[model samples]
Target: MKILFVNNGLAGGGVEKLLNDMLPLINESGNYCELLILFDDDAKYLESLRNNGVKVQIVPKKIYNKGHFQRILYIMNYIKNNDFDIVHANEFPLIYYCSIIKTILGKKMPKLVMTEHNTDNRRRHIKLSRPLEKLIYRNYDKVTSISDKVQEVLLDWLRPNDRDKYVVVYNGIAAENFRNSKPYERSDLVPEISEKDKLLCVIGSLTEQKNYFLC
Candidate 1:
């Protein structure tokens, strides 16, 4: 299978590191792994892929900060020229582009997969951008929420039929990669978390309505 990975940059963020960690296992499965990073930030992971003999491509410039419609053309052009069996986006912003604009490149666009990494309710952008999301997300073949809470939040807003399109795919850690690569644990580097007496936990942002704070 030819899989194309879309990310905003090659920064050492959670999503970026996760993809790099999983690349070896996935490539060993005989899938062609191609990376299409919108940002040209450092390309820190580029050498890792090349060293492993995996095929990677970086665009000349990032179109991420550009307006949505403009990014549509840039992404669509890229997808049109690339023959990929699947296109998966790790972030929600890219998810919008993949599901909406990527479909216009061909009658049968690549199977679209989006992984929701954050709490759905925490997303302030979505409430205001519901119309845009409804149009684009309809084009996605699959939508994965990383946790049950995210799935529930999505269900409340999504149509009943659209519920079937979303699945709860738990986020994970690459055990083998952790054993081999000396990557820094996020919480360890952050000063707030205690290394000896506690476990690191993720918390979503508080939501504010027209007059009240919810959750």
Candidate 2:
């Protein structure tokens, strides 16, 4: 299968990391996988992806600078020319853009899939954006969420009649790394630690959506 994964950029984020880990595996399985990043800036995983034999393409600088519409046109042309079997979008505006392209292409467009990583986003808070959101999601052939909670919340928010289109695909991890790792001494890491003290670790980007303060 020929698949094109679209995202904003290859920044140091969970989505980027997921793509970094997932794309190579897809390629190794004999499926042709390519990445299309909207911006060329802050591409932390570009070299790593290329080293893994995943074809990574960025929007042309001239077209990127031209404005939103121009970039959309570029993406449309790129997808149309690539002849992909599937186009999986991984982030916000890119999801919206790909939906627009699918709507325009109709049956000519490839199978459109989007992964919803979060349970909430700014778009959900806007009262007027609901209708457009519904339309955008309707354009997708399938919508995947990172967890059951995310899928539940998304379905509740959109309330689409075709509930079967949504599915839960849990995020992956390199379990062997954890299984083969050594345990750290509590006293060595924290000299002030008590023998009976319990430690809690929270890992994620310190973004507003993470709600670190709540933790």
Candidate 3:
């Protein structure tokens, strides 16, 4: 497939690393994978993608918040002008991008896919938002999430074309990385955790749905 990857940031973030892991497999299969960064301006971690001979494009955002508007035009032109089997995007903003543009252009849109990383993050702007999701859901061919928890949440918010459309593809670690690293002693990140006590960590953005507490 001729795939174009759209990402917001590429500073060795989890989403970028996910793309890094998948690019090798895509390259080995002799398929075309192109990288399009919405915010990245430097070659921070693009070496792997370049080394694998994948095409890269840094879509310059001439305007501020209007960058999303520019991306809509750029992507529409690319889709209308060239041949791309799939357009894969990570996170919600890019997902929202392709969804809106495809609606405006009608039938010439490419196949849309998403790799959602988190379950708790959701849209809170549109009330009774099921109608909006129902519309955008028609634009996406498939979605993959890291865990079943996320899949369940997605099924509730984002309707899919097929029941099996949402796949739980667990992220994998390389055997070489495991073999190279030695087991180190474990220590409590927080002080004074007894045997009866426990350590827990929660990860999410500063969004309100995350329910983070400060005190």
Candidate 4:
């Protein structure tokens, strides 16, 4: 199977990390795998993916700020040239883009898939975006939520018939990768930690969903 994973960029985030873990397995399954990163941010994970035999492609600079139609055209052209069988979008905007391809191009496009990694977002509450969101989501072959909570949140907003498209695909890590990993030394991140200072680490983005203010 030819599969393409689409994302805005491979920035440091949970979704990226999850994809990082999934790529190797995808390749090992004897399938052709590729990544379509919309914008370049000099992501740290780029090298690791290349090392693992995943082909990564970035959209050209000219298409970045033109408009939605132009960006969709760029994506659609890429999809056509690559002949991907499945296009799995990591974020919601890309889902809408894939939806457009499926809507206009019909069977000419690949099967559209989207994975929802977050429980909340601005689009759900915006009245004007709801109609478009509904239309796009209806075209997706599958919509996976990272957890049951996330599925519930999506169900609260998605239409009843669209509920059939929803599925809970909990995120997973590659446990074997940590099997032979060396223990971390103090100077790795914080040089201030002498050999004795106990360090408390918190991992999350500084977004409202993380609720870092309470921490």
- Candidate 2, residue 41: Cα displacement in angstroms equals 2.0
Higher TM-score: candidate 3 or 4? 4
- Tens digits of per-residue lDDT, candidate 2, 83-160, equal 899999988899999999988888999999999999899999998999999999999999999999899899989999
Candidate 4 accuracy as TM-score = 0.86
- Residue 73 shift from truth in candidate 3, angstroms: 0.4
Error of 3 at 122 (Å): 4.6
| lDDT winner between candidates 2 and 4 | 2
Best by lDDT: 2
lDDT value, residue 7 of candidate 3: 79
Which regions of candidate 1 are displaced past 4 Å?
62-70, 120-126, 177-215
lDDT (10s digit) by residue, model 3, range 87-132: 8888767788788877886667678888878876547345587777
Give per-model TM-scores.
0.73, 0.91, 0.74, 0.86
Check candidate 2 and list the clashing pairs: none
| Candidate 3 lDDT | 0.72
Worst 10 residues of 1 by lDDT: 206-215
User: In model 4, which residue pairs have backbone atoms overlapping below 3 Å?
Assistant: none
Q: Mark the 10 consecutive residues where model 2 has the least summed lDDT.
A: 206-215
Report lDDT per candidate: 0.71, 0.92, 0.72, 0.84
The alpha-carbon lDDT assigned to residue 168 of candidate 2 equals 94
Error of 1 at 193 (Å): 15
